[model samples]
Target: EGMDVVSFASSAGPNNQQVITEQQLSTLFSNVEEILEANQKFLLSLRQLGFEWTNNPQHLGEAIKKHIPPLKKSYMTYATNFYHAQVFLLSLLEETKPGPLMSYITRWEKEVIKIDMSPLLSYLILP
Candidate 1:
């Protein structure tokens, strides 16, 4: 899918010049989707735990410990890649006008780039 909005800048053919290639965008979106999927899986497991462990408060720590490793791995992946992605997007925005890539950048910001994972990282760092 693609997004569109009004553009005050002049139109240029796809081949005229490229700020980012199609392949780069695809890879970026794929990474974001993978991270989202991992987080969703982690949340689902926690929900399931809430039901199954409702009567086992003492053993909650043991159950929760198993989920943390994978969640940490997923977040570590994000922390590793996020800066490069941010720099890439910011540079692209600086180079191009607000028309062609605007919708895609907006989607990236809303879906993935806007995430603030610092507080979440504290959990991993502390325990």
Candidate 2:
């Protein structure tokens, strides 16, 4: 995608060309929605597991370790979807008239980073 964008940009003259169309925008939006839905599902699954273990740490730790593979898989899936969404959004920003994308970029830049639990859970479960 980056190579395609670079080739397109190089071929163009001084003035910017409208490379993105309404159809492309629609498709990107749909892709973003799908990514969001998947993220929500992953988060919901994690929350459910957390809730289930709230009363019993030992049992919860065991369950988490037993389920590590699925949790890691889901986390990786979510991360990939998130990266795709970011790329799509960045492409849209460069190809279309700017609007809220800048705000989103700003907000994202300001957001704090936290530890991911997929790897952390194993250490946490160790006695």
User: How much lDDT does each candidate structure score?
Assistant: 0.51, 0.45
Write one digit per residue (lDDT tens) for candidate 1, span 15-122.
Answer: 664434555454333244455566677677677677667677655676568667876776677567665555554666576466456545455455543465343223
Q: Provide the clash count, candidate 2.
A: 0
For model 2, residues 44-68, the per-residue Cα lDDT tens digits are 6567777666677776676556666
Off by over 4 Å in 2: 1-57, 81-83, 97-127
Q: What TM-score do all the candidates reach, one by one?
A: 0.52, 0.31
Alpha-carbon RMSD, candidate 2: 13.1
| Cα lDDT, model 1, residue 104 | 51
- CA error at residue 1 for candidate 2, angstroms: 30
In angstroms, give how far residue 107 of model 2 lies from its true place: 13
